[model samples]
Target: MNQFTHINASGEANMVDVSAKAETVREARAEAFVHMAAETLELIVSGQHHKGDVFATARIAGIQAAKKTWDLIPLCHPCYFEVEVQLEAIPAENKVRIESCCKLAGKTGVEMEALTAASVAALTIYDMCKAVQKDMVISQVRLLEKTGGKSGHFKVEA
Candidate 1:
């Protein structure tokens, strides 16, 4: 098995040194789900939420979060990348599905950025809708796929 990258021989936590790793096109995609009441979903979909433009606000928040992932996470390296965040409100499921994709040509992976984007996006949704629904649940924050670096390509089977 491969040893942990962030741990030195002395077992102290440290950032992985990707300096020697070749610069490759790295991309990562992540997803998050926010479950809420059907009424709350209707409020957002119908544009009747008092907060105003919930989707737009959440989208902006996600993008901002993706850009600052390196600063937020202690070990993440700051690298330029393109980020896309999409939010879908599923009425039948009474949930909002947020998906984020981050891509860049760098020595390190953008998985943390993608995951951060999705998670913060979900949180923004909850923050906007909390007035109406206090019990909203943010769940299933996960990495859906990643490509590039030594790991090559990965996609969740289920």
Candidate 2:
């Protein structure tokens, strides 16, 4: 059976030691979807929402979240990295899609940071539009791709 990296032989949870691991260039991308009503989408796309630029605000939130991932999630190692977040409003689909990418030269992967960025961006969208639509749903928050580390590369199948 495969052993859990975060679990010791005594079944106690612990942070994985990466001190001996070589620092290498690592990159990860994550995505999230915020589903909302057509009217809410219109309010955002038409620039009629009182909240100003929804996409821009969400993008900033995502980037900030990526940088603070270690503080948000326990056991995550802090690393210096670059992050990019993009948010698109699709009126026809009645949803906003967020994509976040994090890169750095570190022993640990940045998948959590990417995922946190996407998730936080989605939540920011929902928060900005909550006054207009209360039923907004956040979903499909997952890592889309990752590169580097001992595990190599990974890409989600469409």
For model 2, residues 1-158, the per-residue Cα lDDT tens digits are 76788888799988999999999999999999999999999988898899899988999999999999999998899998999998888878989899999999999999999999999999999999999889999999999999999999999998
Candidate 1: worst 10 consecutive residues by lDDT?
2-11
For model 1, the superposed segments whose C-alpha errors exceed 4 Å read none
Instruction: Let me know the TM-score candidate 2 reaches against the reference structure.
Output: 0.96
C-alpha-based local distance difference test score of model 2? 0.93
TM-score of 1: 0.98
| lDDT, candidate 1, 1-158, per-residue tens | 97988889999989888889999999999999999999999999999999999999999999999999989999899898999999999999999999999999989999999999999999999999998999999999999999999989999998
Query: How high is each candidate's TM-score?
Result: 0.98, 0.96
Q: Clashing residue pairs in candidate 1, if any?
A: none
lDDT, residue 73, candidate 1: 93
Worst 10 residues of 2 by lDDT: 1-10
